[model samples]
Target: MQYLNGKFQIGYSIRKNDEEFVYNNGFLYSYSDDPEGINEWHNYKGKKVSSLVDPYEIFFYEPADVVPGKVKITASPFWTVTKRGDIHFMMNNVEGSDKAKNVHSYKKASDSEFTHTTEFPGGELRSVGNDLYLISLENDRPVIRKAEGGTNDWTVM
Candidate 1:
């Protein structure tokens, strides 16, 4: 039951009665101390699998490290630049899907990472004096929304 940084080290044995198997990179690993010294490897669905040469070589990944409910961006993002020269965009996810199509901002043009600004409807994003505003069409009419401070709260104007 020894782990380092959420990864189970090799040769560590779990309790025999522990029905929960270990998983790493979507592969399940099971420990055994039988006379033949063969470890069982299975998929997440409990089906037997042999994709790995040795199960002990695999490190069990912690479930908390796995990102839940992550979805892919389905369309192009509306990009805009702030007055302070920062970049921002409103990304679009799949239509009619429960996933987020949120707005994100970058501190600089060369930055590889983006900060999540707020969950916004499909719209054209504009930066007004370093503030984010969305111009979206709602009910066949154009609506303007402004972000409140640095939070996800927005106000329709």
Candidate 2:
């Protein structure tokens, strides 16, 4: 099955032992799946490949909208496609927490560069150059820096 969300498109196939799902964001294609379900899922379809499978039945949510920069699909918690379809934000839940989370939040910066953010407490995530940065308030003061490379790698002037 194939689904288009702005600049990103998703293709998926379910098989008995090896299922594959791929997401295309203009510049690159990313994929995931389980190998065990490939054959079983493939066999049912036989030679018919063009037939539309009911995505609504398999997914948790219905597609609310599809446009150049956005697509909303019904999933466990709902999902939004952004950046001409380069980004996909899926609603999720944190383990042992009552609040819902947004997983799979990715944005394409270019044909070769993409970024994603995971929500945390009292902070915002962003990308600067090739690094991921976080800005948060510490002791009522704004603390800004690269999140992964090293401490003090970034400073507020």
Q: Rate the local accuracy (lDDT) of all candidates.
A: 0.42, 0.31
Task: Provide the lowest-lDDT 10-residue window in model 2.
Answer: 18-27
Q: Which residue runs of candidate 1 sit more than 4 Å off their true CA positions?
A: 1-74, 95-100, 103-113, 148-151
- Which lDDT tens digits does candidate 1 get at residues 92-135? 43222243334443334344334554445657766666677878
Judged by lDDT, which candidate is best?
1
Candidate 1 lDDT (Cα, 0 to 1): 0.42
Q: Which stretches of candidate 2 lie over 4 Å from their true place?
A: 1-8, 11-77, 96-101, 109-113, 120-157
| Deviation in Å, model 2, residue 138 alpha carbon | 26
lDDT (tens digit, per residue) of candidate 2 on 103-128: 33344433332343334332344443
CA RMSD of all predictions: 17.7, 14.7
Clashing pairs in 1: none
The superposed Cα distance between candidate 2 and the true structure at residue 10, in angstroms, equals 2.8
